[model samples]
Target: MLKTAYTLLPALLGMFLLNGCDSSCCMDVPPASNNGLQAPTPVITLDGQPLQGNLTCDPTTNQTITLTAASSDPDGRVVENIWKVDGVESGSVVVCPAPGESKQICLIAVDNDNLENQTCVTLTANNTQPQEPQATPPLPVLTKGDVDGDGGGLYLQCDNTHDTDSLHLYPEDGPFLYGSNDPKDIKEITYNYTYYKADGTIESGPITTTQTEFNEANDQAPGICKKWFHTNNGVATIKVVMTALDDDRQTNTKTYIYNVADGLLVEQP
Candidate 1:
């Protein structure tokens, strides 16, 4: 009986020591911690106003819409801002919305971890208007002649009362000659003339006759090779002939007939 009791005592002591070791080891181990990591928070705003999740806009009446956001990670991670129109990502600078009557512009803020927070805004635009028409002025008329009909002398005139600016004349046919007067003031007066051949070819210089006060007494001289007839006796003969040379070198001749029936210069032919 003494031997059995001693053996049982050692066994009981072993059981007690094993129980204490298990209890101490289990009790010393700590529960898992949830302190280090946290969810990211993304904040969004527009122009200057805070915004909710997504946005919808009117196409016809809005011109511009701006969106912005603030996003953060509990781990203090760095992030990039991304922009999108509707669902498609866009360039750095956002463009106004398109396609549908209502447009949606979105902006998203993302962390280095690629976690994202997004917000959007809407805008509407109107159509453009048209412009008006302009008016034009009329053209002037041109005519040929000795406008004032001043007889051949120092000053020659071509009428241009209806002309807007200075006058221009060229010989109608071949061998065209052109000239201008000393005082080329169109308002006060200046003249241009052209002589044409039978075939409508230019003959003499389109001589720009000088301007002067009208003198009815001074007979206008004809140009070169011009002829006139005197008809006192009903017989018409060449009475006046203009020389081809300049006026200073020209000459005039008159003829009188002495009829035996009359003493004085009775008639001129």
Candidate 2:
């Protein structure tokens, strides 16, 4: 079970983070004034524009990433920024994995009114092996892309198959909902994604997403990529789990699994 407290206030005022509230706690925060308070928006906007997601990290040293708000209310609104991972409130500046592994992280922004919103991202540590030192060494230059239309469809891609990169799982959709637990907040759905290899070995669990790196596949896609998808040959079976919740706390989770042998591509079942 998750931890709980009377932390409705204080330096530790994010107990009600609401990343996955279960009803009794996520009540509708009063509006800034008379009646209706607008639901908080993600940094990419509720419209689904490309948010700068994905991060290509240096595999040689420890790195630090600062959380960005999907959507911050006007300049000031008595709100607090709460950093979270896998549905728990945490400290800022998460420690990333050393070279050669992929990791995912999530964060939620909450206000004094008890309202909240969230976003998740993935960080793939470089897998480059050191080469003999050269007088004039070449540095890897990463690039990025921007959102297309004024507003359009929901599009996100995760990629790690680079010049000499190895097995990795990539997130293709958003798997987070900040206020899903609160009846009053946007019910962002949570999911379960799994990957299995050709040899029958399987890697599975909640898929986290992160910004993509330059020169890599979908290096220009918005939103974070998924995690827990590290394979030696890049071949595997895939699954996506979607859940629906009923008022009394009952849940209806549906599991959809597929097979993919290339580009994390799924064959129709």
Candidate 3:
């Protein structure tokens, strides 16, 4: 007829421009969008219990296991809740994990449309280690030339201006009292004296001397003294601390500084 209708109108206009419209003309599609953004669902708990896979805990009750971080945003509202453990950022969702140690433990979840989401858990700790407490052994160190032994010359025997001076301490290996009669070898020798008065005003006590334990005749009596009253010849210092208290109260101090010259007793270098 008009040359077969002009060859079927260019093959039916090339099938309506390559099928953009075929059985009766139709085109209208705009339905796949994600602009509403939703991604944030991370949760990990412990005291309330839901973790369900790997967790061993119990650091021998040396206590510390809190972990509760949460989050969930189907459309938006989970501003941030991130805690990690082996990857290292956890100042507070608490997880000690060190006795046998195996930590993975994560929680991320960020969305306000910034969209983040994480969740992990491994945490193992409990190989029986927790018993560390035994440290208290250090108290025995007395050496000031073993208590000032040859600078000894307290010649104020009666009274040159004031009196009292029987300061002689002797310990050349005699009286750390381990003599084995064992009440822990019984020791308690304390002598304290501190009188620095040359118008500086200071006087101290403690020297009744029962001299326990090592009695080499209690070192011939008259052990620690200082009761002076001599103003202006100006030399009155006598510190002397000597302490030795064993039987587990464990102590051993020795400090000396003597300079009382009106009749003499020097020792101070």
Candidate 4:
């Protein structure tokens, strides 16, 4: 029996070695595996130049920029590449910030094994001159007339009768009017008249005047010799472009069009 047992021990040891088991234990263990997966590496480029770190751009010239990425994986294939601007995924087309602004740009490369790598850079827009506020156009008031050609604009009654009308254009005074919240004093006003003749010809002329003089003339009586539109031609279309300039050289211009029909002058939209 002892000889049989010794012979069986050597056979058991051989079985353990063949099954990849340690000599201390007789249980079978699988060999360690290495799939050799690797994370992707992303290389970012801005306008065909390699992006190493932060970048500064001019708002006037570099309003828009193109971003791209080249990604690779050592042991696997890169399946996707994503670009993000200001932490939002915005693809490759990046809208540069306004003057005195900054944005974050990032690139992410993903491998087939769900492994990813990211690279980011900061982009700042250079500061520029402070922009001036836009001037507001003047507002026009139209009132119906009591007599022939009497009211603010040309008055058209229920019978389509033509009458003198009053049309007054007021400069911007407050936010409720045509101007900004902070009202600016109007320094000058100019009127450019364009008459569209029925014969398909156009006549244009610039009427230059100061605001003080215009107010003195137009603001006299409610309807006496006001700055109203009138035509001696049978029927025509007239366009009056009124430009108002503030004290800071900011200007706002508006066009008022009037159409004459059946001897009645009517303002068009």
Candidate 5:
């Protein structure tokens, strides 16, 4: 009986050891720790301007503020970024105390993990006004030229200086020696003035002149004279010429060095 009892005890001990092993192997697993999650940093701005930057705002309206949060995890886990204003989950940006006589503003930002950052800004609106207009600029001085006179033969001379909006021509002195009523007797004369711009751009113009005429008489007139001047564009030279009908033939002639600007002639020396 003693031997049998010893053998039964050994079996019972073995069974107890197996049960302990099974209990440990089949135990329920404890839940994983979520404390490893990391929160992202938040970025903040005002009026589309960078933080710590110059920001302008109307003191009479609630200014809209923007906040952006970025986050990532090493486990490639997909996490939704959460936004908060002040302390609540009311989305990304917030407009505090609608604008009105207030010149100060505050903005805050938060990320998915509740990480946060904030900025404060001050704005001054309606503080100063614009000033009034001043006096107008002076008008430009103008001078005209006459290449021919009434009647038909060129024989006249006069000063044609005047203040005008643009270049003008006048028959300051006239009365041709031999006159003709035919329209062909009339000629269109041109006085050219050439100048240069600051950027080396050439500017030329038919500053002034008169119509044509026909004449078959001996006459020696000073013709037309030009005085080129510069106000805005660079210095330039003026060219003067006369045109008339002599015995039904086109007669044209020019004067050299008649008009000069800064001691320079219209034609290159």
Candidate 6:
């Protein structure tokens, strides 16, 4: 084997010399490396504004936000951009979601060098809801005038049959009976009646009679009712508090003041 290899070596050297073999004939040099190349960083902007930390859409618009991003390879390579919303590819705009819905958006840009630069922008979907109107104090209307001219106490009575009735005032007559039931069959507010007199004192009446519905009526708006009373002929201030019947958990109160001259509320005194 050694003799054969030695004999072939001279022949091979002669052939190479005759063929004019140069340094290029024996080996191949590797191509240039790409390690020196850099992966670009994409510049991301939303609504023409540079992104800073987490981004939120303008609350007033409640609409989609326009996205515009740019990337360069420094090698002057062409760059391609990809946008996504909640991981789904989309257009240059990010759309808002239905009321109470929220989502995210992302963008990825790649250069022609096969090098990729990724930048992601987030868009939070928002649904604004209208504010509810607040409940206000009840409005009350008074039919009868001030206290009686003659010294007289107030009278209040309830009639269940009516459920709601417009209690009328006398034609400048004298005071009616206290808790009067002249016409008969009128139920009074048993346990819930409370009054504040002009004398600056408070009174609670466990009247202990049948209670009439304190529902919405013409005298007062819904969820309100009024109680009439005959008070001192000198002076009387009456206050009525009505509770809301529904889930609103509201209370309404109103006060009435009058002067008494004789036995009735004073009209001219």
lDDT of each: 0.37, 0.42, 0.53, 0.57, 0.38, 0.47
Q: Per-prediction RMSD in angstroms?
A: 23.8, 34.3, 16.9, 14.2, 22.0, 14.5
Q: List candidate 1 stretches off by more than 4 Å.
A: 1-36, 52-62, 92-95, 98-100, 119-269
lDDT of 4 by residue, 49-80 (tens): 78877887778765677788877888888999
What is the per-residue lDDT of model 2 for residues 1-269, given as tens digits with 9 covering 90 to 100? 12344443442544344243555654675432322454354452212444467666775556665445555654325366666654567765555567677666665666555666667777677887656432221111111212223432112222221111211112233322222222211112244555666676665445733322222253332333222334334536655554432222233444544444433333223
lDDT of 5: 0.38
At residue 72, candidate 2 shows an lDDT of 66
Error of 5 at 60 (Å): 1.9
Candidate 2 regions off by >4 Å? 1-35, 42-51, 68-71, 74-78, 86-88, 130-269
Model 6 local distance difference test score: 0.47
lDDT by residue for model 1 over 123-215, one digit each (tens)? 333333223322111111122223233422111122222222232332232221111231121222233344433344444434543323223
Q: List model 3 lDDT by residue over 71-135, tens digit each.
A: 77888789988887878877535555668877787889898768788988887878886675432
- Candidate No. with top lDDT: 4
Candidate 4 backbone clash number: 12
Worst 10 residues of 4 by lDDT: 156-165
Number of the candidate with higher TM-score, 3 or 5: 3
Worst 10 residues of 2 by lDDT: 136-145
Q: Write down the worst ten-residue block by lDDT for model 6.
A: 157-166
Model 5 C-alpha lDDT per residue in residues 65-122, reported as the tens digit of each score = 4544433344343245544433445655545343332234433444445443444445
- Stretches of candidate 4 above 4 Å error? 1-36, 60-62, 129-269
Runs in model 6 with CA error above 4 Å?
Answer: 1-40, 47-49, 57-63, 77-79, 96-102, 112-115, 124-246, 258-269
